[model samples]
Target: MINIVYVESSLELVPSEIIRHPSVRRNAKRKGKPPEENLLDRSLHHWAMDRLDNSEKRGRPDIIHFLLLEALGSPLNKTGELRIWIHTVQDLCIYVNPEARLPRDYNRFKSLIEQLYVDGRSPPNGDTILLELRKININQLRDSLNPDFVIGLTSRGEPSSFETLSKSLCDFNNPMVCIGAFPHGPYQKETASIMNKQINVYPEPLEAWIVNSRLIYELEKCLNVYNSQKIL
Candidate 1:
């Protein structure tokens, strides 16, 4: 039920889209360096690592979100000029318990949507987007899908994640969203409990996707034949 996947930016994506991480910026400044430099820069990496080490030394939570990309020599590789796109999630992590070990190395714990994309724009000639939309419609036609709970991941509680997800909400009900390194103020207690179990504070990458797929499958089973006819 758990789906672990990897996602890489298409060649059309701009390289700068990845290097603008707050963790990278703040760390860059402490070392008397410019934050504009990419993490790939030897000087920048050393400076960022030093800053991270310093934070750990001071007992400040050093939560980081690692953006995974394809390694060099892969046949699908398309990056040219040694572009940097992995630092986009520099300082993003959830904290279910303040005293718990600050979740570091988030890169090692991310779930990718294989062959899926995050960019808003669809593929060339609008065919790819149309095809995807058709697939969703087709899936709905084949089964009943209604999710009972929904959990969301937002980098710094940004409204964009909600906005982007809302566009797809027609597929499910009002599910809960886990924002930032912390749960919402009202749902903190319940959210914390969920995080502790399946999520592992922020839902381990593998577990999170598995839960997502299960929810979808369950929703499908719950659909009524009458409702299905109406939607289709």
Candidate 2:
């Protein structure tokens, strides 16, 4: 199986330092939840987020939402050839079950993530767990996967085509691709340190979801998950 890890994703609950800010408090009140229970959202808590370092790149759970929707809804994932994981900025690793059907509505998605944070797993009392959260960093996650190869996709890396990258990946029993889930900024030092190799698929930077779509499509092609005859 090919593992897709979204590293340093900007998905987390409101930090204790800013949980009591007016913006966070009012948003929590509006949603009938405690400030600490809400997800840190730049859209709703921009004024308060400004106080945090790297404020521009934080508080973006939407990036993770879009990336997950793209990766989970692909033929690669459907064929059981793909595994998805999220390593958040807070050093939390979110394991995503292949069968998980995330909510398409953004508000509902946010609510589900908040619930995951509180319960440590989704469907809190179900026999099957769709999502699970753990207190592990990127390095630990990489070691746990023990993939044959680990690659990080970033604008600063050596330029390559997705076709070439996918072809190389097909030669391995299990390979992992790391993509940044934040809006702006380079991969954290800890994340960059674990990459077996780093590559740039495009000259200009692309949105995380766009990169996911392109990468998954190329991988599907290389793995024969989709073919010309099938479409016609």
Candidate 3:
């Protein structure tokens, strides 16, 4: 099994400076856009490379990187809140059957983006399509993949990105964990109100915070339980 690390960040906020390949440079030149020169991009690139080096020493494939962007700027120092903002974005890398194909509907999402970039056409009414997809509800998603565990991340009120998956699979009674932490600027709260026993938070420098040993074991146990459940 492959371990998945989901980063909470957005695609747009990611700086292009991290791209070191000559091909990327050539492409940018062809497009007549200036080369990327962003600190975050370089930092991410270094972060990934460091992970790669560590993996190589262990005689294993490098860890896959997934960036989940929340709000662009939410530094702990700026917010003065110690919330473990779980809602935000999720970047997950999972192991799948190489021969297994993604559902056609997944490609529809990609096609919308491709049309925008390649053909300079607007996406099909996204809201209408999303509303239709939402109507499918939880059971359908459970039957589709039968994932080992469904990690749910959420912020204050509305559904965050990770909440989308958990809401979709609520039928499985997936161990829905919500961390009530929002990024800095406006939404930062004094103290997070705990609702369910399953929901918890960690200290600031949220990304660097390591999972507690006991909590890690608990998470593993939960994963096993989810895996053993009967799919609808």
Candidate 4:
């Protein structure tokens, strides 16, 4: 069984700092504007963009939806061994139930996230699978979860292959894969410091969902826990 942890996930509702994005730099160049004068200057100006106004354009963490689809397709969901967490930029980590059947409407999912950002806590929706929102850091996660191994996906790490990871991790009992959920700048240094190992599966970066789904799929295969054969 494996738990998926998304660090510095861009799962915020609105007013997320935008200056961290490469596009902001590109936009500045196109407009002949000087680089961000400083963090304070950028925060007051370019970083003030709201992601809620245009989620797709800002690259919100919509990957949560697809992560559910793929995990539920495997035996991992039913086994009660699958877990997920979204560690936001503000350290407001969202814990999601692997067994929770998500609403078919994507809007419901989006709304719940927005509400979390506003409320600073999980809503009291009856039987909402979004279990809890806690103020925690990477250290807390590692201490509480006590995973047998941890792997982080980042471009700065050594190039990785699924076959190599699966083989190397075969001896471990429980593993958690960390992928940054943001669409912009690289994950924070604090995140990299906590990982047991890091892997750069692609020559360049890939979307979070692509990296997540493929990694989980390959891990499921290696562990002999895929659901396909069980149905047959």
| Candidate 4 least-lDDT 10 residues | 37-46
Model 4 scores a C-alpha lDDT of 0.64
| 133-169 per-residue lDDT for model 2 (tens digits) | 9988888999999999999999999999999999999
Q: In candidate 4, which residue pairs clash?
A: none
Per-residue lDDT tens digits for candidate 4, residues 1-232, read 5777888765543243555566556654664543342211222233445443433233354556566566665565565556777776655677776655665576566555555655554556664645577878887887788989998888777897866776666667778778877665666677777798888888887888788777766776766765445432
Clash pairs, model 3 backbone: 6-91, 7-68, 8-68, 8-69, 9-68, 9-69, 10-69, 87-154
**How well does each candidate superpose onto the true structure, as a TM-score?**
0.23, 0.96, 0.26, 0.72
Q: State which candidate has the highest TM-score.
A: 2
Write model 1 residue lDDT over 1-232, tens digit each, in one string: 1111111111111124333555556655664444442222322233444433212221111111221112112111121111111111122111111112212343222111111123222232443331111222211311221224434342222233222343333354433333222111222232233321122222223332333334333333433222343221
Candidate scoring better on TM-score of 2 and 3: 2
Q: For every model in order, what is the number of clashing pairs? A: 6, 0, 8, 0
TM-score pick, better of 1 and 4: 4
For model 4, what is the error of residue 9's alpha carbon versus the real structure, in angstroms, after optimal superposition? 0.7
Error of 2 at 10 (Å): 0.7
- TM-score, prediction 4: 0.72
Tell me how far the alpha carbon of residue 191 in candidate 3 is from the true structure, in angstroms, after superposition: 17
* lDDT ranking, best first: 2, 4, 3, 1
